[model samples]
Target: MYYDGIGTEANEKKGFELMLKVAKSSSLGAIHLKHHAQFNIGRAYFEGYGVEQNNKEAERWWIQAADDGSPNASVLAQTMLGMLYSRPDFLNLKQAFFWHSEACGNGSLESQGILGVMYLQGDGIKQSEASAYECLKEAADRGNVYAQGRLVQLFYNKKLFTKASDLARRVVAYTDVEELARDTGCLAAYITKGIAYACFYLSRCLALGNGLRMDKEEAEKYFKRACELDPVVSHDFHLDVAYGIL
Candidate 1:
């Protein structure tokens, strides 16, 4: 009630003090409150809320929360730990990998996607396309759009055209035809590279009937959309269309 003046005058120090007290003395009977308080302690220190910004203290509290062993708090703590470890300022990919692996195993789709991409590039672990594919596939199957986008290229490079086409379709669906047709290049510039890449592959699949029925008209529409959204995408589509590859 003190933190944001909820039902009382705002007092960040009082709120933080109470949180610290609960975090330090809570017993097993208050396991849930204890871990959450620990996480809040980390956030308070990290954000300099009624306390000096201390990265070391913040990290220690987060680790303490993770060790407290609440499944929900553990997943969140692991994710935060992974993000901190992966920060450009720090660059501790090994520590990032460990926490991300734990979070992924705990069913964090975000961790699964990050770990999969890391594995694909050997960013702290040995490069393994197989591991990347498996990890991404799990997250993609759960409707993670980012994982689906990454999988489009991975499956395409591996000649898994069917899988690539499916993922490509999912990724390209982000581009609404009505919006593309109405928006100018300035708006198109906001489209992400991953979406454009997926559109290119999907356009080719539709044009060539790669494991699916041919739809030249739809393929042309996607090709045009892809080109309008990104000239980089146009380069490949133009060459393939000119050479009868489409």
Candidate 2:
């Protein structure tokens, strides 16, 4: 409780001691403890936090934790391994896809989002816009900001303006840009969707000469904001179309 802050202030020392205690008594707890400890140890090694920085050691511990069925740890390990394999000297696209697929199958939103991008871009897998859309939509629905931005792009490509606008509204309502900036985290998928939707709305407003004056600048700003958040191919493509560049 103290370790997790359930009922008391968080204490890493106490948490470590309690983990050790649990490991001594139950095999399940032991496995979890080992997995968590190795994950933290890997991070420590990777970041040089109270330990000498060592990518190899970090990989080793991450792999051990992954082998122990720690889903998140496995995802991180697989991503790192994939990155290593993707180097010019290695150039193993197949292996990269394999690890990424494994992590995606295990429900890692980051992996899914990356996989979606890869599919969309035909990076390693065959280019399949439909597949990318499906993957991104699933991840976005799960609250991945990156995925949400991609989803907005997908909607724009399909000319589904109403749906896109709805998605954008949801993002604007649910996301906090300041908080995301502080952590350098992606905005919630909905937020990206909302920006795209807002851009589309602005464009429509300009075309119809609604209450707002016909302002290309305002429309462009919204579009730029959407691009800044996600920058998916479809969003860029649509921007070109809207500006007569397509």
lDDT of 2 at 117: 72
Q: What does candidate 2's lDDT look like per residue over 171-233, in tens digits?
A: 545456557533433324534544554455445444444434667776566656656655674
How many pairs of residues collide in model 1? 0
Residue 196 of candidate 1: its Cα lDDT?
A: 69
In terms of TM-score, how similar is model 1 to the real structure? 0.63
> What ranges in model 2 sit over 4 Å off?
1-29, 68-76, 79-92, 172-174, 177-217, 220-246
Indicate which candidate wins on lDDT: 1
Q: How many Å off is the CA of 26 in candidate 1? A: 3.0
Which TM-score value belongs to model 2?
0.60
Which residue pairs does candidate 2 place in steric collision? 145-188, 145-189, 148-189, 168-193, 168-194, 171-190, 171-191
Quality of model 2 by C-alpha lDDT: 0.61
TM-scores of the candidates in the order shown: 0.63, 0.60
